[model samples]
Target: MVDGALFAGPALRRLRRREGLSQSAMAARLAISPSYLNLIERNQRPVSARVIVQVADQFDFDPRLLREDETIGGVDGLARRLSDERFADLAIDRDELNEFLAAAPHAAAAFARLYDNAAPAALRDDPIIAVRREIERWRNHFADLDTAAEALADELRLSRGDTGAALTERLRERHQIAVRILPNDVLPDTLRRLDLHARQLQLNEMLDPASRTFQVAIQIAALEFRSAIANLAAAPQFADPSARGLFERHLTAYVAAALVMPYGRFLRACEGTGYDLAVLGRRFGVGFEQLAHRLTTLQRVGQRGLPFFMARIDRAGQVSKRYAGASGAAWLDGDASCPLWLAHRAFERTGELCVHPVLVDGAGGAPAHWLTMARTVNGRGGARFVVALGVEAHMAADIAAARGISLRAEDATRIGQGCARCHVPNCVQRSLPPHGAVLQFPALEQGVTPFRFGG
Candidate 1:
């Protein structure tokens, strides 16, 4: 059984809501204080083994059943949706996912079912399928695009103080378009939209200043660099028309990031600050994610930054989006990353950078040692996400992240590939035995390990 320390508050909340029982009623049935029960349900306190047994006995079912059936299915279903090809590169957290599950279980179940079976073979073969494939293939680096964007950045003379003004002036002078921030009701679901006939760029007033600035830069790029984007998208590598179109759109976002942080200046700051994202974000007036995204694109010919791999995962350990700085690195495309990774730990303490020197097994030909930095960020509608960035140990030493730490083998944390492929023996955190490895569970004795595998 999972320990109470890893208390699942969301599951407890769902269970209570499902049974139509008040907090007091449930506490009385479980023979616990209502205040303590409230804490457990709210995830402030983990439900102890005693409480679990009491709940099982009171509810007249196995305690394990409560956990197994609670919200695992919903989370798994949502993970599948997030991993879909269309959302391969987007950081999407459904705002209604939890609310819908609580208010209408049947509807939520139906939605999950529909989403699970939503994509057919034809849909998977969409024209833009290659765009996502190329991103993964290139490890998220676009040397040509980076060069082009750098040139544009230098031309625009972009800076934090004047990016908004520059883009606004360009929109009006070059495209004869106007920028307007509309109320939430006017542009409820979108951050920004362009109306060609009205010659106006509409932005939602709900967005923060940084986000609004990004939207404006993207619009300006779309208007000014249409030919450049189209030419890059029509490369021989792109097989489908939709792929070309999507690539074009991604190029605009890349352009926006490049404009915000010009390549030469950003690289200088990065080197000076030892790749500190917070410092870079503040200097560039961008968000953490934007800074990280820009970091991945810093492969400009002879002038390159550290080789970094970045990933965005939800609280439930689903990897929504991932990108590598160079070849030979492994990214957990669909499976849950190792639970022991500091990235997951950051969820407990959000907005703080937790550093770990990890030895990654089965990472292709990449260096075994890596210095990783993990932090959690809150998204729209109470959605929390963890972002992790890492560089090989050799490259990490010069960076400030490696300071105040011993880099010896003994000091490093030994992490395996995910459970399915991991071969580590006697690990308390092992979720599943390694595939094809026989397990010998002696009845007479049990070690701290749940299972022992035969060599």
Candidate 2:
């Protein structure tokens, strides 16, 4: 079901057994008998839940991870070769493999590598799984920007939203520039740069005010910070041509945000305003979603925000965007469902702000703090995505005024339609996965909610 050799990687096994103590002094570290620990390490006894807890809690191991446990995963020699059939009967040097796995854990991605090689067609057909990795890779690279933004946010002592807007306003004032938006046809998928002196920003001028601000910000980014953005996007993982293109696009957007909200100066505003969305939007001439997107991009190590994470969900459970800060809080795999995702209540009362708090414990089983602010926003016709975040609790007060946006709120935050994607067992509106969660049930049931995913 999973990678075979993953359990047998000796380096991983050794890391598990170390327990933050020398092998000889292991007994003192755990306050347990070293002989018992030896037996456990030598495959004499299966690692129990209690032992797992001790290792994780005591030595800061991710306790919920099952890979270390033989019951869950163990890097045995046989498993390693089985997973890599090329090495089968090829006399693998166990010591060499251990050393390789020890220093370069990610290089030993046997599961996905083997699976991809085994069935090329499967990879092509399953865009959901194929794109999943790419999405996260993009998210990760974008997320790193959080450090710079966070430092700026903290220094400003203002809400991140406020920080972004303030920084944009500062840019406009400092540069004496005007912001404008155009249609998708007018603007390219990413930003462009022309002569600032000629008022020559060729763009999609028909877009909304927020979109306009974003375009200008992107232009400014390309002009002021192209090299920095390029450097960040160029890395080992992003070497592939297609992947690099996607990475650059994502970074271009980020550079736009960064320009609109220079981290150091913007961070001060964020702390000052407590991350008020509307005011911040007004400052930067961007939208609420844009401001929130910038908030999660603060990943500067020492100068950080309250460690906010962001996810955009539509009526259905498809996650359109997920950006996790340095918190290492992985998003749910395969579009994990959340009942609180629906924000129908916000639409009933226009201009009323509401907070529905929910916790997301991902596949790894860690509680992710998410205080999702689900207000309906206007889309092409009906409604669109409900935006929320996993932000720090301390900044809630600053954002209280911004959350009361109800005039544009959609039914259950489904955005654009009542049932476009309400596949909560029986959503009648779902024709497919809007946010891109695979539908598991088409034959077993019919539409129950406003959206359904079964064909």
Candidate 3:
């Protein structure tokens, strides 16, 4: 479904079992032979489009579920968990892992959970990391919320009018809540606040028009989609209350963006415009950062746009926001990205789109090439942050900014995940020695790199 053969046997089997149907019974319902169904369930054959349509029609479920199940805490995650040094002695191969995942998905999920529980205290207990992992688990796409927001957008007629004005009018007419733009001095510490007793939604006067619309949409989401947000936040993975709260806020924001852009219209506009950020910003009445963030969420099945990864980094190289979407860029998981990445240089040419093509050395795998676009975005209270959006190099052809950009291996900048994890030789910008490498020093001479390490 995503420009590839869909091999989702485990998901298909799970669905059939959830529906309380035997293989023969489900096969009869799907108008397929039992042997063929078995083959599909075993992942020996890809799930055909006809079969996906039949499943959707008969089960009354989103066809995306099959694909989602395939990735969510599935083989890739299990493989990553198994790659840890603690499990290095086991030497599990890919085919065996695949067979194990297919044969016992619940067991595989339990193992993943076990692996998470076994992680170091810093990673296991951090609420922010927990929420991020949860978000990545779903690839930042919430189908139900998107559907609900799309319906709400249609009902509010958001696409036909000024978005901010439409949301403001809706709040006043339906909810009887007046929206007030208070002086920055009055709301110095907050961008938005809702006073229930006063029946007012207050915003800081410093917010731009696009941000004001987004804040209003958030209020609407909090009021209208409370149940959906709560349901998503209620997932068992969020053991910590802080994680649940953070996830709930994130879901509200996602719904707000969906309400503003509406999935179908946004995807069409993205594809039509070749993903030109400026043009899409003008059309959607959103800012560049918002557009980039929304770009990471267009993972609807059979209608996916490019699998973009987005990050927001400050001048000090601290990453504040990261969504790994399908790009799976290793830098997102690190505390700091490579200095050579365009994101770090975005502040030098503020407000201008800086594009770069780079090859990232992943963990013990082939280097993955990416095309990254970065620009500085004005943050709250005069602060500025660089927002970078990236997609795999192969998928960059459809992007307007990537036009005439060379992604050839020889032309690309080679970067590591981070200084501590990178093993790239002779990198002058590396601030720390690569992890798991022995440092070597030549007493007689000094090279450009401060630290030399054996690979």
Candidate 4:
């Protein structure tokens, strides 16, 4: 059932779906020829490293997942069966092979497997995969450790769950790691590793103070809250130990965010700062992207706060992550990926700020409003994050006044597909009501757009 063209097609399609975009819209957003995007999706072309990172930083996607080779039904098994010397005369260069890996994942995996089997007697298992497998087992130990540590977190009023701060103190006093921040390039991408049993934590020294602080806090989280994050992440799903370890590493990042904002402090900051993204970023010592992500996690029952939504993007208009706790309407689940959603405007103005007003009508058929802000950010790479922040419609005016956002949550030069695909009629940007939208149009001319359904 898995063909070469469809090797990674499901993942690619999922990415598109999560953005709430049709293929043509997504292709346009990325500024690539639709044909090119189609080719890549169909496994006719390889996705470049630049595209990989663009999707990651913009949509907060996992680059490795996109680059991952097929673990099953891959041609690598066959390739491993043949000696490299045998193919030497074929003139298929290593770069071309890598291209094949990126483009046709199943075929590449099969080739690697085959090649490894035929490789010299001493070499067979992939060292990277083997090492990661071990890391995964250690991750499970962390779950037990966290259970023991939870009550202590509650007692200290560490509602901020100060894991990173605690870790820094521990490592500096007991282990002497001398935690330092260098440029991300200067440091290893991996969080913490021991050299001669001496812990070393490296980070991008050039980060904005808030971002730098986050990196430091994240390093600390890896040490202090590893158990808490591990406990939550160790659920049985990831089949490979290597994959599981990567999942834990991502959770480590999540824990660090929780520690820095401490949910309690963050919710208060939202009220105090009027849910202003910039002020919240500065107040919590977190970056725009970081604050944006944490905003979505504020739904903790009685201890809960506004279920603010968040997402990120780049100049090319590709989304990195789209999260919403309110409706569980994930952009990743395919709600809104249109280029004209006022979200893409951030890329054009670059440093210039933008505010978008949105109206949301839920399943109950009521309209809610919200005020949004967007701007561009640069980091390890050129123009990395295109930040977007939105708050509840009721708070839109008060928030707009304080944060200098748009008062009219509806009026903007809105054009194109985002608002159009929506179901709510009377929506100005609605090029077409959704599939089941009630058709209020009386005669032929009233309904200017196509889809008019009263379901």
For each candidate, what is the lDDT? 0.69, 0.49, 0.84, 0.54
Candidate 1: global Cα-lDDT?
Answer: 0.69
lDDT of 1 by residue, 21-134 (tens): 999998888888989988876656767778888767776656654443133244323433443434322434433444444445555556655763466866556654446545
Q: Candidate 4 residues 5-113, lDDT tens each?
A: 2234446767999889887887766667778778878766666656666667667887646635534212322222221223323444334544565556656566555
By TM-score, the best candidate is 3
RMSD of 2: 12.4
Q: Compare candidates 1 and 3 on TM-score and give the better one.
A: 3
Which candidate leads the pack in lDDT?
A: 3
- Candidate 4 similarity to native, TM-score: 0.52
Candidate 2 error regions (>4 Å): 1-199, 234-240, 327-332, 335-340, 344-353, 361-369, 378-383, 392-455
After superposition, the stretches of candidate 4 with alpha carbons farther than 4 Å from their true spots are 1-167, 182-198, 239-246, 327-332, 360-368, 400-455
lDDT of 2 by residue, 80-136 (tens): 223232332233443444444443444555543554467667554454443334434
What TM-score, computed on C-alpha atoms, does each candidate reach? 0.67, 0.50, 0.86, 0.52
After the best TM-score superposition of candidate 1, give how far the Cα of residue 395 lies from its true spot, in angstroms: 1.2
